[model samples]
Target: MQKKNNYHFETRAIHEGETGDGWSGATLPPIFQSAAHYHESAESLSKTFAGETQDHIYMRLSNPTNRFLEQKLAALESGAGAVATGSGMAAINNACMTLLRSGDEFVASRSLFMSSYTLFTTIFKKYGIRVRLVDPLNLDDIEQAINEKTRFVYMETITNPGMEIADIKQIAQISHTKGIPLMIDNTLASPWLCRPIELGADIVLHSTTKYLSGHGGALGGVVVDAGNFDWTRERFSDFAPFVEQRGRLAFLHRLFKEIHVNFGTTPAPLHSYLTAIGLNTLGLRMERHMENAIRVADFLKDQPKVEWVNFPGFEDHGCHEMAKTQFCNKGFGAMLTFGLKDQAACFKFIDHLDMILNIANLGDCKTLIIHPYSSQYISFSPALKNKLADPQLLRFSLGVEHAEDICNDVAQALEAI
Candidate 1:
């Protein structure tokens, strides 16, 4: 799919970044699974290795299948360039390693995926990098946390389990004032619901393992450079070499050459192929996911056994208006969290479900549910857990299945409880 014209998202999702096979005329991208490419002459190989020409040097650096996937993702997110990673954590770690050094710091939204929290507090902390956790909705807290050492600001488009929406445009402006970029974790919203780059994000990250792949099969991640932020600044002095060489592509160039290459976070070609195939129907799948999610959220709101419901689509949700404005009134995401009578009740409800799978993964073709308190947030202290996780909370990832069937499963499970 060559980006021939300015097409709609649905069309771009299917057509962009895919050039049909010259030999076989295959509509879909073929998996290029070779470990290394052979060059006709030693001089050509040397030139390729020296960065004098564009060629695949090794699987750890790049692959044709992966490049195809990157192009599609960048186009979808309205980014200048993108890099595929081994997993979601790899993407986050790659970005952090490229930007932050010893004694440097970064500000992040308090409501984050448990693994992300762990990565910052445990892994990054060991390297002498400081992370300040602040409320995404509180600009004052974000501004107060920033100092000379702050490298960038980070937040999720839709928080995990909590479903809170951040004001990306406002946060981007705040980050720009201090000459730092805003990085958004857009795994939940996907490009179908929101493009963070369009909303003023400088860089966008995603766990393609989730909604982008649309199936729970492939584990992959991507980092997109929006090409809007200027890296030639005193704060980002480390990027000077890349900025001098690549200009607007400095961030992505540094990401590939400095961090991702050494970290060996390159995704497998087969996984990239799967993700590309999954993305073709992303628009269709998200529509049904949102539709089913709203019905499920509404149904849970009126249930006697349900203690509380937190879905951004609901009018009473604190972030509903912000979500509407940012997402252009698109359907609220498929993920939601609701409270039960207690932890035991939550476990009972999950155990009684016949159709929805009890699993840790989300954004699957089949509906999935998980007890976040026991699974994702099990290591947090009680105080931190109280601030982040609900003891009775059950996070649900609604699939594209019929809304009535999904509601019936929940009703039966609640009745069993």
Candidate 2:
């Protein structure tokens, strides 16, 4: 499919990157699963390896099926280019490694996904990269955290478990003032709900294992470059050569050539195919997800067993207005964290639920629930755990199931608790 600038999001979602098979006339892209492609001549193969021609050399570098998904994701996020990865953590690692050298630092929102927090504090720290965690809503704290070695600012569109929304545009302005890019993890607010690049993000990432796949089957991730950041500034002297060579494509060039390729974070072609199929129905699935979420939030709010709901769709949420403005009032996201009476009630409710799955993953077609304190945030220290998790809190990922049935299941589960 040829991407037309005038195409609406729904049309682009289904048609943007799909170039139908010329050989079989298949409307859907077929998975090119071969580990390597044969060239007609040794000269052509040499040219490809030498960067004089474009061709797949090995599965570790690229695949046709993954390329198709990358194009679609880049188009959907309004980015210039994308690199698909084996997992969301790989995308994060690739982005960080591409930008930050050893001993350099980056600022990130404290309310990050558990694995991300672990990656920054443990893995990246072990490699000598320093990470400063700040409150996304506090501009003063973010400003204070930045230093001469700061490479970029990172935050999620909507935080995990906490459900807080960051002001991307404001943070981008702050980051740009210091000659640093703004990298956003847009997993929760998938491209269907928010395009962070359009909101001034220089780099956007997603764990396609979640909503983009719409099923909990495939594990994949992607980093999309907006192609807008100026990498020629004095603060980023390291990127000068890439900027001179690739111009607006400098970030993608560095990411693909340095971090992604070297680390071998390439995703499987079969997983990419499954993700593409899921994205075709993203607009439809997100609509149902939002609808079901609102209904579920309302039901939980009225229940006497529920202590409080932290969904942004609720008017009382601190970032509710910001979410509406940023998401264009389409819908607040489907993820929510609600508090019950205590840890026992939380576990009992989760265990008693009939319809909702008690799983660690989110963004499945069926409702999923998890207790973050014990599952996702188990490694956090007491102070860190208090900041990001609660013993009585339950994180819920609403699905496209009927609203009434979901509510009934929750009600029965609460009653049992």
Candidate 3:
């Protein structure tokens, strides 16, 4: 309680993963880049492979650097343990593949990151798995989507681009009553803003490529297990061997052994190291990011050329109250969406920007702007694109830059349009 009231996010981000690498008194974990490990004896190596001991056998399995980041992430998210992966989508893929079967189904929020929507509709669909999309704001819609065969319920801490927030506590309750785990994609609401597990989510996933690696040079993802889900139900028959062996670690064990190793989505040690360095400043970055978002959102709303602005920080926003409570009233988030006249106006604004980069990425220390309707959601049907946001919507990822400078740039760009 003391730490939670203090700058716990900052304290935990820097201190939680410090187990002392032993050889060097270095402050941060050193990167374990080698692909192979030489054990003292054949029996020791054999024991590692047999799961009798916890040791790094190969880079494909684990690394000290990746484990360091995983530990820090687990601590920050209040999770039981964490597994790092090559990309955010890799984290989602591995976690879902671990829990789902061929004939199983799952319920998900209609407002999802573009790639996630594709993976659920296409890849999972190809495997004979079904995904039911529903409005996360409606408890009845979420409840109706879950049937007997539903394996889990998936949602985002905050919907990407859509700027929607779920009632996680109530949603978790609904999922629990049906004997299912609630998985949340917490990439946008990084632990500094919200820890989904503390709100009753059973699993949390992140794209460390974003806020966790604030500089945007690293690409990584992670899965944080709360280790509080009921995995012994008969419906989880496939988890029998894993449960019998690992008990509380059944999900982690199966994730590492069956899917992660064979799928080969291992994160590079350098990526983990870079993410760790960025994570140390996460609390700081998030504070400025949220502040700047509010300044920018307030500035954009009054612009004459701007058609509409959607930021949960605004009291009139549909999710404002929910976001307020979920984020502990700290701030809404660093992301917001505003619409222009049309696609042409969006392009004109982008061409006029001086400092902000026109990129397909978000959650950077450097502000980024993207037109999802034409870029990220380009391949989607017209109706689907509009469903997520207006055809002329511009998604802004506020950085730690001076709010005045950012507003000035935005003002000049709108004038150019």
Off by over 4 Å in 2: 1-3, 20-23
How close is every model to the real structure, measured as TM-score?
A: 0.98, 0.97, 0.97
Looking at candidate 1, the ten consecutive residues that score lowest on lDDT are 18-27
lDDT of 2 at 175: 89
Checking candidate 1 for backbone clashes, the offending pairs are: 1-18, 1-19
lDDT for residue 9 in candidate 2, whole number 0-100: 82
Candidate 1 per-residue lDDT, tens place, 2-97, comes to: 366678898889988867444277777888889998899999999988888878878998888999999999999999999999999899988878
lDDT (tens digit, per residue) of candidate 3 on 15-113: 677654453788778887799888999999999998788788999998888988998899889998999999999999999999888999999999999
* Model 1 misplaced regions, further than 4 Å: 20-23
**TM-score of predicted structure 3:** 0.97
Off by over 4 Å in 3: 1-7
